[model samples]
Target: MSGEDARALPVEDARSIAGVPDGFGRFWTPYRMAYIHGEGKPRDASDAQCPFCAAPGKGDEDGLIVHRGRTCFVLMNLFPYNSGHLLVCPYRHVSDYTELTCEERVELGELTATAMRVERETAHPDGFNLGMNQGAIAGAGIAAHLHQHVVPRWGGDANFLPIIAQTKAIPELLEDARARLAAAWPAEGMEK
Candidate 1:
């Protein structure tokens, strides 16, 4: 069928035909299926099964860690809303923000701020989205771990893709973003 002719057909008719152009974009991200299926999600709330508990054990590059602090660490979000998306997590295996010690709370805040600064220096986002999901009911993917999300934003970054297709298009590779942010991270006494 001609492209114009296909467009004129009822939407259901166009999508039903094999080898026919349906006028919808395809991202072909099979990798997202792992996330959809909960491949790496912790089986339980135990520290033994937690990714946040294990990340600090690996080298910085392998772990995609941006910086390590006394009480907390910064790392790139595996499933990012945008390039340079980061999470600030404490080494302790505690759930809920209320469980954080005074020192942990202070360092988590500091690390989250530093994550924003590094993202601005590296990707130059127009602004940021920063928060912590307290529980699974509150949208925390790993409800057993306490972490704060620091998501960088640019003007017009949102579109119909996520709402319509359940997909997000990230422009930069995770490794590349981790490297850039890690390099741009300010030293302990040098943070601005």
Candidate 2:
């Protein structure tokens, strides 16, 4: 194109064109695209295909795992609602809380509590949301697995980016979060 043709086009501020403020910060997590597109999700609810079941077999770092209990474990949420979001899941690939064995139930509860304490010690969030999404209709991303969400919340953490652009700006990397939480986890037999 000639300079005259280029000059004829309307000029736009780069920030306006990019839909972001000049001083606003961003943490681009392109890796999350796979989850958004439903890639790597299980084809069926079989134990062989369940992520919670598979996580225990891999090393802690590779699995984004922060802590491992006897019957349940804590791992970073691949699609987090906030930074340091974690999930506590029983090893057995059960879909409902009612299905958890007594031992599993006890460990799951303990792990969830431990996750909350660890997040507080490491990140010092203002608050937390702890719950389980029982089924697909209840907003369970992996409805086949019974995992409890441990989401750290802070005042003003909900911003326009998530509302307007459907994007969350997480300041920390998954590995970094895992490392911090793992390191801050209370030692075995020690109380928080």
Model 1, span 1-36: residue lDDT tens: 765666777876766555676677454466777778
Which candidate gets the maximum lDDT versus the true structure? 1
Note each model's CA RMSD in angstroms.
5.7, 6.2
- For 46-158, candidate 2 gives per-residue lDDT tens digits of 73677788889999999999888888889999888999999999988888999999999988888888888888888899999998998889988888888999999999999
TM-score of each: 0.87, 0.83
Q: Cα lDDT of model 2 overall?
A: 0.83
lDDT of model 1 at residue 23? 79
What are the runs in model 2 whose C-alpha is more than 4 Å off?
1-29
lDDT of 1 at 97: 87
